[model samples]
Target chain A: MLDVADVHTYYGEGYVLQGVSLTVEPASIVAVLGRNGVGKTTLIRTVIAFTPARRGRVMFEDRDITRWPSYRIAKAGMGLVPQGRRIFPSLSVRENLEIAQRAAATDIAEPWSLGRVLDLFPALAERLRNGAGTLSGGEQQMLTVARALVGNPRLLLMDEPTEGLSPHIVAEMKKLVVGLRARGMAILLVEQNLAFALDVADRVHVMDKGKIVFGGTPAELDADETIKKTYLGV
Target chain B: MTFWIINTLNGLSLAMILFLLAAGLTLIFGLMHIINMAHGSFYLLGGYIAITAIRLTGGFIFGAIVAVIAIAVIGAIIQRLFLARLYKQEMRQALLTLGLLFIVADIAFFTWGGDPLLVPQPPLLQGAVHFWGIVYPLYRVFLIGCGLVIAFCLWAFLERTTLGAIVRAGMDDEEMVRGLGINVPLVFTGIFALGAALAALGGVLGGPLLGMFPGADFEVVLLAFVVVTVGGLGSIRGAFLGSLLVGLVDNFGNAWFPQLSLFTIFVPMVIVLALKPTGLMGRV
Candidate 1:
C-alpha cells in the first residue's frame, strides 16, 4: 500500500504539485485523471520521489520515504513505468529486462519473473535479442510494462502508460492491469484518457491546477455530470 | 622487406600501449560522461609508483601489482570524496578533474625529479626472441598480448554479462537505471577503479618503451584523446580500432615525416569528425 498526503513539489521556484493526496490499496488500481499539464504526471513523480515534495509525507508500507533518493525509494518496492517508455534503445530487449530483474518477493506465491512477464507479452519474447529501438511503438510500450514487472515491486506507478498507444494495444493494457491486480500487485495509474481511466480504475480522482478536484468510485464519477463538465470538459 | 616487417612490429607494439591507455579513458567517458583530466595524471603516477615498487622489491611483478592496486584505490577514493557530489554535473566534474590533473602532475614532478626513468622489464620478460631469423624484444610481444587479451575480455564483459548490461543501460538512461533499484553509485565507483587500474597497467607496460618523465602525461593523453575521438566514445571496438589507426600512423609518421608527426596522429581524428562526428562505432 502507498499513501501520499499534502505533498507540495516544485521545480526551482515553479510550484508543480500543490497539497496533493492519494492512496493506492493493495491489489487495486487507483488512477489520477486530468487533461494535459494538470499535474497528473507530477503526482506520480512526487509519490515516487523522482521530484521529492518540499512539504508533505509519503508512506510506503508504513515507512516515511519522503526526501529519500529515487533509487532507495525504488529498492523499497516502488517500480515506476515512467512516461515516454524510456527503454535503453541501444540494448537488446533481453538486456533491458535483465537489467531491471530482481529476486522475487518471498510473500508472493506466484512472483513475477522474466519468463512469466514474457508469457504475458509474447511479442516481446519474439524480439528478445533484437535492439529495443527496433521495436514498434506498441511493442515498446509492452516492453516498458514488462520491464517494470520484472523488477518484482510491491507497487507500480504507471505514468500515462496508454499514451500514444493504439486502441487495440490499449485494450491489451487494460487486461494486463487487471491480471496484475489478480496476482496481488498495487498500481497507481496517471492518465489523460478519461474513458480508459474510468474503465480500469476502481477509484478515480480528477486533478486540476495541481489539486485533486474530485474523487470517487468510477460509478459515482459517471453519475456526476457537473464535475465532468467543469474540470474534465467531457 | 625486413625493414617493413620491423616497422610493422613497432607499430603493433605502440598500438597496444595506446589501446591500454585509451581503453580506460573511453570507458570512463562512456559510462560516467566525465572527461577525467586526471586520467593522464594517473598514468604518470602509475609509472612512477611501479618504478619505485620495482626498485624496492627488485621485481617487475611487484611493481605492476602495486601500481594497479594503488591507483585503483586512489581513483575509488577520489570518486567517493569529490566526484560523487558532482554527479550528473559533467562540466563541473570535468573542471574538478582538470584541477586534479595539475595537482597530481606537480606531485609526481616533485617526487620523481626531472630525470626520465625507463621502466625496467620483468626478469621473465626480459631479453629478445628470434623467430625465422628475425629478432624482437620479448617485452613488446607481452605488451601486445596483454592488450589483445584485455580487448577481448572488455568486449565480452560489455556484450555478455548482466552487470555489463546494467552498465550499457546506465549509459543510455542513468535515472531509469537507478529507478530499477540498482545502486548505481557503487557501480560507478567500481568502474572508476577498473578504468584507473587499466591506465596504471598501461603505465607499467609502457615504462621501458616510453619512459616516465615530467609532462609525459600530456603527451600520452593527447594521443589517447585522438584515439577516443577517432574510434568513438563508449565503444570498446571503437577504442581498439582507433588505437590501431593512431598507433600505426604515429609510428609511420615519426619515421617518414618526423616534422609532421603530431599532424599524423591528429589528421585521422579531424577527418573522422568531419565525416562522422560520432566516431567509428559510437552508439551515443
Candidate 2:
C-alpha cells in the first residue's frame, strides 16, 4: 500500500537517511529494526513528509506524495504514532481523541469508530475528562495508538511503540499490534525490541548507518546470526 | 460610600471593554504565536467605520455589526496575504505587523481627521439607572452586560464544541494537531479573523465612553499588553481578572491619587510578575 523509493533525508547538513528504499504491502506489518541513530525514525518522518525526502519519491495507493505537506500526507490515509507519545498535555483525553477523528480518505469498509477504540482501551474511556499528561506511561501509549486509529488510516507508522514500557505492557502492545494487523491495517513499525518486532511483523528490514543492510522473513533474520550481530546488535 | 460605588461602577465599565480587547489579543497570540502589533489598529479602524456606518444607517447596532464584519474581512485578507508566509518567523511577523500599525495610523489620521469624535450611546441606552442610592448611566450597564454575555459565549464555545477542542489542542501542540490531518492554516486564519472581530466589537462598544481620538489606538493597545502580561499570555479567565484589576486601579488612582495614577495601574502587574514570572495562569 506504500512505496518509499530511494529516499534520502537530512537533519540540517547531516545525511540521516541515505538512499533507503522499502515497501509496505496491503494488510502487512513491515518492521524496521536498528540500533540508535540508525535513521529508523528518520525513515518514518520522511514517509510522512515531516522531514521530506530531499532526493526520493514516496507513493501511497499509487499516488506520488513526495512533495505534499505533512498534513496532506496524513490526510491521504497515513497516521503516525510519533516517538514519546506526543499527546497534547493540556487537553483532556476525550479532546485528544476527538481532534484525531477524521473521515477516512478512502472507502475502507467498517472503518474505526470512537466506540471501537474506547472498547480496545477501556482505561481511556474511564478517564475521558482527565488531562492527557496525567495518564500513566502505559495508558499514554495506548492513547497514542488510539489517537492514530481514530483517523481510520490505511497505513500506520509507529516509532518505538514498546519503548520504556514494562514487560507486561510491552506484551499487551505486541498483542495490540497483532490485532491491528488482523483487522487489515498496514503498519511500518520501527523498533529496538527484536522479539516484539519478529513476533508481529510479516517482513523485517534491518537498517544500519542510514541504509537497509538486510531484508527477509523474520525466520530468515533469526537464522542470519552475522547480520543480526553486526547491524542490530542482537 | 457614594463616591466608592460610582468609582467601582466606572471601573467595571472600563474593565469590560479592556476584557474584550485583551481576550482577542491573547487568543491570537496563544494560537498563532504571532505578536500582531497591528491588532490595535483594528480597534481604531472599527471605531472609524462604526461612526461612518452609524451616520449612513442611522442606527447604533447596525453600525457596530457592519464594523465588526468589515474588520473581520480585513483581518482575513491580511492574514492570508501577509502573515501566512511569515509563520514561525516571529521577528519578521512582529516587524511586519508594526509596519502595519504605522500605516493604519496614518490612514486613520488622513481619513477621519485628527479631532476626537464623540460616539453617542444608542438611543435605548441614553438615560441613567438608579442603584444603591446612586445614579449610573444605562449605557455603562449595557456595556457590562455585553462583556458578561460575550464572556459566557466565548467560554462555552471554547469548552463545548469540537472545533473549540481542536483550537485548545492546537494551542498546546500545533505540530501534533497538524499531524492528525487537521488543516491548521485554515484554523489560524479563522482565529485571526475572530480575534479581529472581537477587537472591533470592543472599539465600537467603548468609543462612546473613551472617545475616538488620534492616539486612542496606541493608548488602548498599551493597556491591552499590560492586561495580557499581568493576566498570563493565553488564559481568558486571566484576562478577565486582569482587566478588572487594571480598571479598578486606574479609576481609583485617578480619583484619589491623580499624581500616582500612571504608576498605580502598573503596581499589580509588577507584583504579579515578581511572584510568577509567567503571569497568573500561564503554562510556561
Candidate 1 residue-pair clash tally: 0
DockQ of each: 0.81, 0.79
For model 1, residues A108-203, the per-residue Cα lDDT tens digits are 788788999999999999999999999999999999999998889999999999999999999999998988888888999998888888898889
Docking class for candidate 2 = medium
RMSD to truth, every model:
1.4, 1.6
Candidate 1 ranges beyond 4 A from true positions: none
Sequence-dependent TM-score of model 2: 0.97
**How far off is residue B141 in model 2, in Å?**
0.6
> Which pairs of residues have clashing backbones in candidate 2?
none
* Candidate 1: RMSD to truth: 1.4
For model 2, the superposed segments whose C-alpha errors exceed 4 Å read none
Interface RMSD of each: 1.0, 1.0
